[model samples]
Target: MIRKLALITPWPDQRTGIADYAFDLAHGLADVGIELDVFTTCTKPSRTISGVRIQDIDKFPGTFAFDQTVYQMGNCSTFHGEQLPVLFENPGIVHLHDPALHHLIAFFLYRDDTQDYYRVLRAWYGARVAERVQTFNELNNQGFWDSPHVTEVPFFDPVLEHATGCIVHSAYAQQAVHSRVPNLHIRQVRQAYRNMQPPAKYNDGEVLQLGAFGMVQQHKHVDVIIEAVKRCNAEGKRVHLHVAGALESVCKDLPDLAKSLGIENDITFHGRLSEEEFLYWMNNVDICVSLRFPTMGETSAVVSRALQLGLPTIVNNVGWYAELPSCVTKLPTEHDEMLKQLVAQLQRVSTNGEQLAQWRAQCRRYAQTTGSFEQTIQDYVRTLACFRTSAMAA
Candidate 1:
């Protein structure tokens, strides 16, 4: 039997990790003979990419672009209500992106169950003038407010009950789906991971280079990381920081931060890099620090990439990174606590050559064994195969 996959995500001119993952999945599926079509919110659909059929939604002469149409459906716009039926018309499996897509889906589930007679009567008598009232009534009606489909995903069991299967990035998400929707069938797979290859001489250096990977931002703890490095340098440690990435949105307080610290010369701002330059920077990085401060995610694609290239890393103990074996030091995001860990980790990595060597080896081993690109693709291949099974689709 021929199998087709209708992958829906934010694509075309894609930049994010998820976007790249979608591309990789589509490419891998094609390599194995699966028919794939991509519909995305990004650029107008192209007819083909790397041999897979890409439907340019622009050809539809529709109300909005593919992304905009689906975006509203997520927002619960009555206009967006049209896309769901169309999503079902595709002769393949539907792969949803993230949690934010639910806004529009909620309205459909509510209207499907427990009719609202009072609002119906009001709207029946008053058509054009009552548009606002109908929308409000539709949103406010308590009968459908907490419906299973609206409240939870696996709970919306029936909506996806027909879907071949669902793809999620992490074990945590898989557990969440199972715990919430035990009867639903799901295929667990790790999303693709990438890493930068740190040069072998990453540590055989005179100047200690600590990079913030982007402009100074609070979430990234750019300011705090700077302060910690300053403290370390004052304590006879020779460490400098190179802040890379495009400074598209400037942080408001970074100027005053440099002046107050009085170590402005110690830092080099690489502004923004073209795609080629950015990869070059990653390839040369001694340590890639991911500021997962204030929140935790399942994984960090950047961290994974650096590990692949044997780039030693110091990450905030957020996400699944706590499980990896490395010189990973978890510290409170507080300015004080961050300073202590930063200073200590820098001093150790600079002077303790043996320890730094071991940390680099750990990064290489962990990333190579678990996060190799081939392994990630294999996981998805097995997962999509399971979804393609006729029995599972039913």
Candidate 2:
């Protein structure tokens, strides 16, 4: 029975994956007749949807008159930090895009004072962890953000304690949230993506082209993918890699790494791409390689988009990616064997036209049958409506 909603999220103009996702979801919700108020920090709206009203987040007034406020949250501090006060002050349905929120929480709490950060950490995680803040900081300096303590410990309680409900995209995320906040209402919805026209006839060319999308980070294993491409070429297989994402961020050295390996010519870094350019590369590549290690129970929008477009994708068999359909080429988690497996798979798919076609058909079937944007929108409506009913009954 929800007629209207307030969506607190970064809008498409921000050019982040979460922003694009929220944009798509807003349009879907609006199409289903739900009046939506989109609260964003952007000075002007990027795109318009009939039933969605774009309002400056500064004008949020700390509360909403709508039935529910869906807050799109992720791991990035820059994008999600300012919204913490609103989330803490107004209880709403939190659409958690990433289960591990240590960095975001740390950045916000420790921005002004280190002592305040430790005090809050101790209050939420206890003395054992607060005392080891120095160690965590040292390890963080060594780029161990995905280590056991950071990824396993749920740093969400401080921010999500007041949330009325939560929606997660993967089973891994669902389990993580349920373990931390058992009493909170939780719903698992398949990540949403609209099916695009399937890519032009599968490329049967001799040289295999691979693409890696989204924010390129160490966890995404773009370096490993580069190594795999080098090895495949060395073994008499022609392979090229296309990387498109933020290059100025954590993995700025990827181009340098590619150069060091003498495969700079084989790899192309497209930096951050527009939506049209993203889809263009997705269609052009022979295969999409999206590998993640030490995952924070996060699902990839890139993988979802690839599958919906019937593009064969390769995923590492861990965390949320493990739950993907068999149509995707999966690589084992062990680093030693991973390269060999990837090289072998790339060689096989690039050389065999029949196998590639089967994977495409199967992936398209899964996307068409398992879940579509239409179904995802319906799931959101049903889940939101049920939240009110369940609260009343309780």
Candidate 3:
């Protein structure tokens, strides 16, 4: 039985999705009587959040005097920068948020220190992978960070090689990791949804509102949602797009794209909304569109939040989103067909009050029945026990 644990992650103050997840998990663990000490990149002195002690990463004792040390690993450098070094030096159970970790590993190998690039590549992927690493280095030097080819190869072996065990949010991620590293102990845990008050019944007025939350990125296909809304408006359907979260640098031109599509006036960009504002728009929206392509095999906190709020969601039928219950609308895979389907679905839901109400009720039921934070905490506790047993045996 794991009694005390050290959790390494970006805390709530960082304003990243992983940070929010870490804090939530910490709170849940604390509630279950598990002692937890959180370590983050923030250089502030130790503080208490939700009954958990949070300290700076630099202040972390080189070796934790706890039953287990879990590091929350993600692809973003902002969240992983300080945690990565600790992960490599003192490996522990890794909670992999994104299965596609090529970009993060590439950053460490090439950008951080070129000297270890070839050596680390050979160690993880054998001599054959050195050529691929060289090509990656050259392309990275040429400023092609967004190239799909960068993540074509799974470079997560480096992290997995050092991990005592691993935890992934979705079965898809669990399968992906198992296929790559079959012998490793991996647990599939569902991401917990935030508790939300039952929203007041939506009044489908003249204008139908569509919402997209989380960091606006190319893979999220905010552009597609904007295009679908434009088409719906052209077909005599009054539709508007409300986007939450700050526009990422890669997708900064989304406002321009909306302007070019002639739907700028109909779209509202609520940049980095507060919790109150986020829930306000989420509860008010007619439908939530959460689409992603070239998925990292990670679950969406935004989509989970929408489901918890009983808002009908439209997701792309790919990766973990494909596993969503039938209550949520799923867009087809093909680009043209996806846009067409999205436009049709938006039109149908906007005009048909009965269909919209049915979807809302079904989604709420699904969330209420299957999305329990208490269950998620129990799952974590069980999974952590396995790691403890393995460590004891070793």
Choose the strongest candidate by TM-score: 2
Candidate 2: where is the Cα deviation over 4 Å? 61-64, 132-134, 138-148, 195-197, 389-394
Clashing pairs in 3: none
- Models 1 onward score TM values of 0.68, 0.92, 0.90
Error of 3 at 38 (Å): 0.8
Order candidates by lDDT, high to low: 2, 3, 1
Give a tens-digit lDDT track for model 1, residues 1-394: 3355455554534444455555656766667666666655556532246767665433333322221111111222332244455545432233433322334444554356424432443332245523533355468744222232322222223334445456655454455546644655565555454333345555467767666674344567777777876787777777777787544454655645766888787776787565467668777656777675543233555565566676777777643555545545566566677667877888897777787778877766665566556666666656555544232334
lDDT (Cα, tens digit) per residue for candidate 2, span 334-365 = 78788889888888876787877787788778
Model 1 TM-score (2 dp): 0.68
Best by lDDT: 2
Tell me each candidate's RMSD, in Å, in order.
Answer: 8.9, 2.6, 2.8
Task: Give the deviation of candidate 1 from the true structure as CA RMSD.
Answer: 8.9
Give residue 120's lDDT in candidate 1 (0 to 100): 40
lDDT of each: 0.54, 0.81, 0.80
